[model samples]
Target: MRIAIIPARGGSKRIPRKNIKDFCGKPIIAYPIEAALNSGVVDKVIVSTDDEEIASIARQYGAETPFVRSSRLADDYTGTVAVIRDAILQLQQIGWTLTECACIYATTPLLNSERIAEAYQLLFDSHADFIFTCARFSFPIQRALLKTDQGGVIPFDPPSVPKRSQDLPPTFHDAGQLYWAAVETWMDPAKHIYSADSRMLLLPERLVQDIDTQEDWEHAELLYKVMQSLGQ
Candidate 1:
């Protein structure tokens, strides 16, 4: 069996009640829940959250909250892997024979069923420990600068200062959307998602945004609206 676990803790400090906050027309978490269900790749869609309201909203969007997330794993310090691991263990305790798992973020309003399905296919074909979404840096990271205490600017990578942007290798960052992994891999705590064995599905910058603050939330809503207008 395949499952998608969405970790949506309610203690969002930057953006209050971010997990179930309205986005576009529905709760932000609704997007991923709908995407996972619509994808048809996973056998179940589970929302691992500590908030009752979050659980209620998730169920309304076709996701099941089989178990309430622990307060230990709901804090800001808890990492994604630990939350996913806990959910998997809980499912196992409830007699679920999970073969594969995907961790889909609740705040990803731009996520679609196509990308979720594509990532699952890639994970199956690559036989890798994990698959996640990422996007290329709009500017050359190698030429980045740092501000000194005196307000003076300095090159972060001095050696790359003289190199042309085209000559430098490209760099990518986590799009903070979804991660696909086999059940066995997810159960192993030592198996980090950033390992070399993990594969990444690249997405365009316009389709990726991390909604951590109010500004980010506004930006994502606008971006999502534009994409919808274009029928993307």
Candidate 2:
């Protein structure tokens, strides 16, 4: 069965209660929950969180909270993979064997139902182990610089001849918005949300903001407003 698991822990140091914080007049976690529910790709939408408020909000938004996340996995140092693993285990104990799962992020307000469905379809059609959103780098990363011993800048790619930004090949970076993968691949210790054979689904920079800090949250809000105005 297809499932969507959203990991939201309570101990956010960067932005307190970040998962449930207000975003565009709605709880931040609500966006992903709503998207997953409306996506039509998954049979179940679950939110794995340790915070009572977050769980309650998730439930209110039609997401299942089969169990509260463990304290160990709720800590700041805990990785999201662990949380997803725990959630999958919990669901299994309750007689649900998920065939595939999407580890969606609660902070990604720009995630829409259509995008979620498109990513799932891509995974299915391409026989991919996993798929995640990414945005292209506007600037040439080949021309990146590093600090020298004398505080001078040096080209990171010294082997490549110095070229103008317009002449460099394009590069991309993980948007960190969300990820989808086969359950078996994602649960393996060696693999992760993005598997070895994972595919990168290109997304526009405006829709790929990952809200990890106050600055990021503000920037996302601005982008959201602009997108709304443009009827995107």
Best by TM-score: 1
Model 1 poorest 10 in a row by lDDT: 186-195
lDDT of each: 0.94, 0.87
lDDT of 1 by residue, 73-132 (tens): 998799998999899999999998889999999999899999999999999999999999
TM-score of each: 0.98, 0.93
C-alpha root-mean-square deviation, each candidate: 0.8, 1.7
Instruction: Provide the clashing-pair count of each candidate structure.
Output: 0, 0
To one decimal, what is the Cα RMSD in angstroms of model 2 from the true structure? 1.7
Tell me the spans in candidate 2 whose CA falls farther than 4 Å from its real position. 164-167, 192-196
For candidate 2, the TM-score is: 0.93
Instruction: Report the number of the highest-lDDT candidate.
Output: 1
Q: Residue-wise lDDT of candidate 2 within 1-232, one digit each (tens)?
A: 9999999888888898899999999998998889888999988899998889899999998999989888888886888778888998999999997898998999988988899999999988887777989999987778779998999998889755567776777888888777888888777887754556788889987798877778989999999899889987
C-alpha positional error of residue 41 in candidate 2 after TM-score superposition, expressed in Å:
0.3
